[model samples]
Target: MGSTPRRSPRRRWASLLGATALAVTAGGALACPAGAAGTNVDFATHCIPPAVAGIPPIDGTTTANVSVDNTSPKVGDTVTVTYTVVTAAAGNPTDLALPADIMTPTGKVTLGGAQTGAVTVAGPKKNTPVPGKGAFPSFSMTGTFTVTSPGAITLSPGDYNIHTSYILELDTPCTVITPPAPVSETVTATSGTPTNTRSISLSSASGNPGDSVTVSGSDFTPGATVTLAGRSGDTQTADTATATVNAQGTFSGALTVNEPTTTGIVAYEGSAWNADLGAGPATYVVNDTTPVPDGSQKLTATVKAGTLSMSQAGDAVALSAVDFGQGGAATGALRTVTVKDFRGGPAGWSLTGKVTDFTGPGAKIGAGKLSWTPVCVTEAGSPSTCAAGSAGIVGVSGATLASTPDGTLTGGEFTVDAGLSLDVPAFTPPGSYSGVLTLTLT
Candidate 1:
């Protein structure tokens, strides 16, 4: 049981207008004609050709129309390319294929149709059969094109004849189809204005430190690069942030102020597509951390002058016990007092010291037995020298002794070194004694 094999479709279909080697053996009978040259083989009842003749006689009208969704498009716009094809014939053609080619001024190819929400076309498309729709087969397809750059874009499109092998069948049940005409179209893109003009605004009219200030812009060039800058008080420019404009041509960002500086009015600026925007001098205030007085102004400050004072350098002065058996003088610890005058003004000040009698629990030692000399040491120059004084009796003249008649306070401060001596009597107290000396400033 052997079956009959058909000839090669490509080789047999190559000769559409003339006879080709496509023989059919049926019941001990050969179907091919006799001669190979100058004889046309009808494929309607013998063979299936791959394509039609290159320049076959036109038997019907075929038209192609092209259009776009947006005639005026800006950069980053997604436009649609619609192609409507019509063939005035009885029904769908036996073999039909349309290969379209498009050339753009800027040959940049955009691959992402899902991202731009447009229909993607990969290659040539075949004709679809629509029964009872019209007298002839009518088909249409739409492709997407994205405007990437700013400028005029030219689109040149044409359809290629790839189905040159398709031809009408002829013989026992012969049928013929008219060839479709070639079509092409060209377009030039133009510029269009944005939906709105470029404008910028601040989140708030005024704000304080630690608060976030939002800067927003709208109606800018779509997908354009933009940057934000600001200046506070007398400070220089500071770049805050950068963002890309969206499909709506809008962008916004927030900037936080954290430091305790630049208190005056603050202004912001921005630019996109060489256009400047966001000119605002917003008022801002940095409050002092210290609590202000009840009657003081919120923006006012006060500075107070210092005062002059005297203080003991160390703990109370300690004097050793002196036995009456020894008639020699008994010396006490060296005592020092400091006079600090922080006031910058030039003035005069007099220093004095008063002492009470040296007394124990029940015994007493007369203050006249103790005398001390005052030595003046000028630690800081007040533009004058401090006069030193001689020793004076404790109770009689030392009780309230003056520094010196000529000792004048100058440049505000000077130190005094006081030396104390106690003259014990023949039968002084048998217990420890203590006294208090008070230093005064005037």
Candidate 2:
């Protein structure tokens, strides 16, 4: 604060007279009139009152409070401390400079290589208030103490003192006011350490797409967020699942191997994180496979002269009477053809199927008119593109079978589900027509 310019003695007389009269009426302060040139007045004797007869002088009380960011501190962990001092006083503004120290259970603490302190004021507030000499002032001082020692550092809650070098200035004479008693607060320090080890485990060692697997763990920091992720060979994906460590330091939740995940061993990793404890990670595994939920990839080979073979899922496919009736209506049963690769090298194979014209009786149905719709099936129990087909379904020109890798041998064998349908014109002569559906694989 900048000081006001000094006024000449003659110019100060009127204001001084009025201030003296007011001070005398108030009775707390002594009254003194401005002196004449070269005639000095004993200002302290007249303006500084020994003591007020009735009203008690207003004074301030100091309080120290502390809080720690992390109650459990561990190696490599830095914690923060918030210390605040509030003084309640309603009187003339008294400027006080109070020193504060953060001490461990054993000794005092220094943050940023310096001692901390709180300066107090009078009234009911600390910051900007209605400014005037008689306005009761109240204020508070706060400091952040950072503990970077990593290990255990006890936080003393109220082990501090509010020392006052408080000074009071008046209209004529300035008198220093000192509290008769020393004010200090005794406090207890709280300390903790982080030294818990974490471990994780999976419910099972393997699973298929959409299979539910339990992820369980223990010894993690309480209330920490844990995320689970999975990786298969070169492909990585995040599980849309997470768990929070409970008060007992344990976590458990069910996560699913997302559908369409690659057929391989998927390695799962989970980690728990907290602001104070950092991160702890663990790993597990899930073997994701095909048609069979086989954790072990055991491929038993059955060799034959052919590179591919086709067979119906159940008995021979039986077409209903409408399929053979006269309206050009087509109908048949669904049959799955299992194609096995005995001739495994990397060279691809193709399947071409055709039906011979009905020849069992006097009249026949043209074989070329028959059509088949085939959907390729993958080991993952889902429909996939055939290795060598455009429409994938066979027409009059005959459709080519599709295999993975275009031509090379991928999984030893694959299955294809095909629907057989025959068309009969309404005018066509009909006998018990019988035709052989020939599916040749190369």
Question: Which number leads on TM-score?
Answer: 1
lDDT of 1 by residue, 1-442 (tens): 1222232111110000000111111122111111111111111111122233223233333343444434445544445444443332223233344222210100011122122111222112233333322233343433444444444443322221211111222111112222111212222344554333354544432233456656566656677666654444335344355666789977776656544442222222344223234322222222224445678743432222245455545444555556655534566533455555543222334455554566665766576666777777766545545555556765523443233221112344567776677666656646566554544444
Write down the lDDT that model 2 would get.
0.36
For all the candidates, what are their Cα RMSDs to the real structure? 46.6, 38.9
Q: Looking at candidate 1, what is the lDDT of residue 299?
A: 42
Q: Supply every candidate's count of residue pairs whose N, Cα or C atoms clash at under 3 angstroms.
A: 11, 14
The candidate that wins on lDDT is: 1
Worst 10 residues of 1 by lDDT: 13-22
Could you tell me the TM-score of candidate 1? Answer: 0.29
